[model samples]
Target: MDAANLEFIIQMLEQDTDLKEKIKDQVTEFDKKTRTMAGLLNKIHSTPTAQLPPLLDSVQPILASCTDITAVIAQLVPANQFWRWKDMWCNSLRSAVFSATLIEYLRSGTLLTLPQVGGILGIHPEWADRFTLAAEDYLHGLISLVNELSRLAVNSVTLGNYEEPLRISAFVKDLFAGFAMLNLKNDLLRRRYDSLKYDIKKIEEVVYDVSLRKLAPTPAK
Candidate 1:
């Protein structure tokens, strides 16, 4: 082919502003849905501990709808720009995981693993690898979860629940240890990981205060 023809072919194959815009619109929907869920999460966190169960229950349908929106986004993304939009969807995915874990922590005070995060986003766990950004892997979202849990640890005590803080302390410490095993190359993730040290200390302090006061639940003899 002539040089002009070759250039035109490359442009046709590579230049995809129109599709990119459509994908952006879809991502905007995902963003909106996830943000709504985040708002509900804020409410859940702020609610009195006794009221948290009902708040969580009310948000369950909203979270499911957000996951549906995420699924729609995955289907709407054009194959040509799949990789191009990965970064755009990162926040939405992170929010979905946050919502999922918030529910789990409310119901059982359990740590939601990366695999379960996928289920929240309505995607299989394996897809987590595909969506990992070049600079920061998707697992960085776990740091966001840990961050919220730290705050929750403090709030749980104010709400008169010491057990949740203890559970959160154990979960955050375990998660931090797991992250330590990774040789993270991303500066953003590394910085986030470094900050986790302080968060872990904060939760530890909360647990320590409770134990020192003899307010913590007694262990079985």
Candidate 2:
């Protein structure tokens, strides 16, 4: 993780031409100082005093560079999805985006731009007629789930009944479990992307078969 984080930072820095030049300048300075110190150290091999300045000066910029990189990595943590629920939703979005992208790649036998995928998926107003009814249906279900969760959170806070809140919590957990199913679907989509090497339409068909059982409610403690 640390290596990947560092690599990503370096990549980002390298991509920014101005930042790359600055980093290169610091690296050049550090290298020059290290070489100059090494030459001095060779002459005063046994002298502790001679070795100190080069060692200290040579290390300062490297330490500063590391500190800057560390700070950048620290900032990326809050931006990463593993930290918070809102951020986790970003993960969910990524999973969805990749899945949709995979689908488009499969169907078209070529990589499609995001707007193109959105268009193929019935999202764009101009190309709505080209897509299937299933696109609208799936989108509606997803929106409905989002609205339901929002409503539940609001009601749970407003009611302030402990039991009701617990029930809400259970419902939220089940909703997460449903999302887990979607994650699994995404994993499957990724695997298919790797293996099939083409677009395959995988319908997410959720069957609702209702069943009810009467049981005594848990007694309040």
Give the least accurate 10-residue stretch of model 2, judged by summed lDDT. 202-211
Off by over 4 Å in 2: 1-136, 183-221
Task: Point out where model 1 deviates above 4 Å.
Answer: 1-15, 78-81, 124-138
Best by lDDT: 1
The TM-score between candidate 1 and the true structure equals 0.82
Superposition error at 149 for model 2 (Å): 2.6
Tell how far residue 167 is off in model 1, in angstroms: 1.5
Full-model lDDT, candidate 1? 0.74
- Model 1: per-residue Cα lDDT over 1-221, one tens digit each: 99999999888766566656766787688778778877878775567787888888877887777656656565656544547678777777677776787788778867776656666656743343334323243466678788888888898788778787888887788888888999987687788899999999999999999988988895566
Give candidate 2's total backbone clashes.
2
lDDT of 1 at 165: 82
lDDT of 2: 0.34
